[model samples]
Target: MTASYVFSVRFRLSPDAAVSVEPETFETTLYRPADPPGEDGWLFFRDNLWRGEVNDQRHARRLAEDALGVDVEAVEFRRFETDREHYDALKAAIADDLATFNADSVSEVLNKYFGSSVEVVS
Candidate 1:
């Protein structure tokens, strides 16, 4: 069972670095694996994402830059692609921590953090 978080990243050449065709900016898709909901590191989305996008843009940009080996000017979360097991597990986890989120239900919590960006795959 593999799951990943997708993000759209915009990158620009570092000004100090020499470039051949002149400094240019471009956008690319980035994927980061997601841990199981009950496992360590599962709170990554909660800490870094909100409302279907990257809640902390600067932090997300740095992460994207590190992963892509480019200077990321911006980063936006696209979605979380996972299997049904992961989605169910996430719901269970969210239910357990409902008080922490101050939400009345799992759906509300999911909306608050992930919005409509959760995609259950095969």
Candidate 2:
């Protein structure tokens, strides 16, 4: 069976900031065999909270820091093995958004779910 991994990063806003702000967290995911393919060989997902390809942990961390507008204290990542059942369920959950991207296949659906970016290895 092919293996797919989800990469996640957690970040907290700087405590010393001028404005009072609550800490927030964000995450991004990348799929193997990305739709339309990528030069680095992975698909990326960009969201309001986070952006970057899964394989490039540094890029993900930088994206989080940029969003938070503060230096991140720590970053964490987790990987999961996905199967058709899980993938289908995920597709179902985000079906409406996928349609917005005019996704015709699973890869297209995932590409839309994340965002447009070339995958790269660290």
lDDT values, one for every candidate: 0.87, 0.45
- Per residue, candidate 1 scores C-alpha lDDT tens digits across 1-122 of 67899998889876555644454788888989998887899889889999898998899998888888888889989999999988888889989889878899999988998999999999
Q: Which candidate ranks first by lDDT, i.e. highest?
A: 1
Clashing pairs in 2: 45-114, 45-115, 46-114, 46-115
Q: What is the C-alpha RMSD of each candidate to the true structure, in Å?
A: 1.8, 11.7
Q: Candidate 2's residue-wise lDDT over 1-122, tens digit each?
A: 23344444455545556675654544444333323222233233333212223445566567557755655544433433455554454556455355544666656655544444322332
Clashing pairs in 1: none
What is the total number of backbone clashes in candidate 2? 4
* Candidate 2, poorest ten consecutive residues by summed lDDT: 34-43
Which ranges in model 2 have alpha carbons more than 4 Å from their true place?
1-70, 73-86, 95-97, 111-122
